[model samples]
Target: MTESAPTPQPDGLDVYVITYDEEGHEERLLPSEVTDAVVERSRDFGINKGSWTIDRIKHGPLIAAESQLRLVNVGSLARAIAGNYYGTALIVDQTPPPIDEDVYDIDRRYDVDVVDDVLVAVVTQRHPAQPAETEAEIAARLARIAAAYGCRIVGVSFALPGGGTPEEMLSHWPEGEEWSERFRAETIETLAGMAHDVKVSIATDDNVTMATLMDGAAAMADYLSATQTGPLDAAGVLNLLRGGHFNLLIGEAESGYLEVKTQMHPISAPGDTGKKAKVELAQDVARFANGDVDAVLVIGYKEAPGGANTIGSLTPVADSILNTAQIHELLDARIVPPVDGLIIEKFVVTATDSVLAIYVPKQPSEMQPYLVHGAIAEGKVEGAFFSIVRRRGEGSITTSAQQIHAYIVAGKRYLRGND
Candidate 1:
C-alpha cells in the first residue's frame, strides 16, 4: 500500500498568543504565528539580528533568538514580546492567576500579570439607591452564568468601592479604622454566608482582575467534579451541616434524589392526634425507595414566591414539634418492605431555628417497589392497596402500571441470577 502524507499535528503546547491593539481590541494567534511575530519583533528591537528558531519545551514552546549579548534574560525577552508586539501568551497549566493576590501596587498600576483559574465576581457598590444585592441574588446570577459554561461557582470574593488593599483592609478591620466594627462585621457575615466552604478573600484591583476570576472559577469546577460524591451518606451529610457548607447544600436545586420541605407533614402531632403525619412520612420514604437513587429530604427550607427556598424559621423542630425517633418508627410501621439504612437526624441551626434531614438509601433489587398501606392525605395514593410511589423532579407521583411492571421484571431477573 502507498504511504499517505503525514497528517499535520497541532502545537503540542496548546498555547494562545493574544495581541491587543492600542484601541484595546484583541487578536489571537497560534504557536507558529507567535514564533514569526517574535522573530520579526526581535529584529525591530535591535536586540537580535541573527536567525531565530522555535524550540519545544516540556513546559511550553520557546522562541530561541540567537543573540550576541552574553547576558540575556529570557524573562526580559518574554516581557519585550508582550510589550513590543502588544501580545501576551497563555499556557493552559502555567500562568494561571493566583487568587487572593495583590493586583496593584501603591501607585495603582498593573504590577503582576497572570491568568486566573477561578471566577472572581467583583460586586462593586454603585449608586447607593441601587437595592442591596443579597447572597441569594449573587448565587442565582452565578448559577445562571456557570450553567452556560457547564461549570459551578467554587469561590466568591468582594471588592468594595474605595476599599484599600487586602492587607490594609485586614489590619484596618482589627483597628476599626475608617469603617465601623459593625460595618466590617456585616460585610464578613454576608460573604461567609455565601462562600459555603469555598475560599473567600478580600482582593485589590491588582489581584481581583476579571482574568483571575475566570481562571479561578475554571479550577474550582475541576476540583468539584473530581471530589464530588453525589448523595452523601448520613455521616457525610452531617459533616457538611457542621462544617458550615449548609449554604452549599441549600444552594442546589431540587433534583431526582433531593427534596426540600418547609416543615414536617401534619404540622402538629400530639394536639392533632391523627396518623396523617405518620402516613405522609411513610409516603415520602416509599416514594424515594421506589426510585432508582437515594434521596435526601431537607425540612425547614420553605419555598418562597419566586420558587427560591430559604432556610425558614424552625419553630416546630425547636419546640419539639416532631420527634425524630417517633417519625422513624412510624415510617417502619407504614412502609412495607422496610427501607434499609433510613436515617433521620435533627440539627440545631440556632437557638430557635433547627432543621431535620431524612436520608433514604436505595433498597436492593430484591426489595424493589416499596409500597404504602394506610390512607395518606395529600399523597399520590390515598386509601389504596400496595401503592408504589415514585419521585419525579421535585414531587412524588403514583408509579404508572408500566413502571411497576418494569420494576417487577427487573426484580425477577435478579432473583433468577440473570441480572
Candidate 2:
C-alpha cells in the first residue's frame, strides 16, 4: 500500500535545519545552510534528497541523543521548537507577539510547562528592577496564555523556602495581587464562562519536587478512567496527598467515582463558596453511596464544568476552613444507611491549604440505595426531607424507581428464603 506524502511547507518563512559539526559546537543552519556532510547524515536517516517538508525539518535531528543522531545542528530541539512554535515565540521572549487578533503571548516573567498532560504555569516573581506585575497584568497574562495555548491555566504555584504547600497553595498574594480575594485569572474564566476563548482554574492556595506531582498526576489520571480504576480507595490517594500532587489533576475529567469540589460547604461552619452545604453534602454522599461502585469527593479542586466536569484547577480548602471532623459530621448527619466503611481523611497541601477526601465504599446489595434527609434550601434545614442520589458517569443522577424496586424485591425474596 502506498503511504501519503508529507505535506508541503510554505516557502521563504525562514525555516531552518540544524545539525552539529565535528567540532561539537551547536550549529543552526537555514535551508540554505544545509552542508554536504549534514545532507549525507540526513540521507542516512532516510530523509533522502527531495523537497524538504515540515516533518522532515521537524524530525531530522529531534531524536538525536538516544538514536545517537548527535547532530550538533539539532543541539537544542526544545528551544528550537519553542522558538518557532506558533510564529517565532522563542525570538521575542521580552515582547511576545499577539497569538491572533485577540490572544497574545504570555509574559516572560511566568513560565508555561506541560507537566503530565496538564499545563502548569509557574509565576517567577517579576524583576525588582521593573515594577511588580499588577493584578491586571497577571490576569491579562493568564488569559493570553490560556487563549494562546487553547487550554485552561491551572493556577499558580509559589515555591517558597522550606517544605509544605503553603497558604492558598501560594496561588494568591503575588507581589501585586496580595489584597484581592478573587484571583485575577479567575475573572477571565468568569467573564468567558467557558473553556475555549479563555479560562483559568479556581485558584487554590499552594506546590513540589514535581516527582510526587508526576506520580500523583499519573494516579489521578488512572482514577479518572472508569476502565482503569473501577472503584476508588486510599492507596493511590496517599500519593496525591504528598507534595503538590494536586496540580497534576489539572484538566482531568471527572468520572463515576471521581468528584472535585472547589469549596467547602457551610455545615454549621463558615464556608467559602457553597451556601447549601447540608443539601450538597447529602446529595454528594448519597450519590456515591447509591452507585454500583465506590467513590470519593475531593474538596479543594474546581471543575471547568462543561459537558464533562473537567477538573480545572485547585481551590484550596484549608484545614482551618474544613477538616475531617466536619466531613464526618456532615456525612453522618446527611446520608442514611451510614455509608458503611466510609472513610474521611485530610491531607495538608500547604500549612494553610488542605484537601478533604471522602471515600464512600461500595455497600452490600441490601444497602442498595442510600438516602439523604434534607428539606434543605439555601443553607436552611427543614424537617423530614430526603433525597436519593446515584452516580452515573460524571454526574449525580436521581435514583431510578425501577432500580429501587428491584432492590426492594430482592430484599423481600431474601427475607422469605425463597432462593
Off by over 4 Å in 1: 1-238, 267-273, 308-316, 376-384, 401-419
Which candidate number would show the highest TM-score if scored against the true structure? 2
Please report the TM-score between candidate 1 and the true structure.
Answer: 0.42
The residue-by-residue lDDT of candidate 2 on 1-419, one tens digit each, is 99999864322123245455788664556544454456322211111123222222232212111111111122122223332323221111222221121332222323223333332333333121222344355455444323322333455432223332334333553646546545655543442332211112311111112222223223323333321223334344434544335655566567877787888776664542343666778788788887776677888888875756777777887677676776787778777878788888777777888888788777886676778876454557654666677777876567667977887887898889965
Best by lDDT: 2
lDDT for each candidate structure: 0.48, 0.49
Off by over 4 Å in 2: 1-238, 242-244, 269-276, 305-308, 376-381, 400-410, 417-419
Lowest lDDT sum, 10 consecutive residues, model 1, at: 104-113
Candidate 2 accuracy as TM-score: 0.43
C-alpha TM-scores of all predictions: 0.42, 0.43
Q: Residue-pair clashes per candidate, as listed?
A: 16, 13
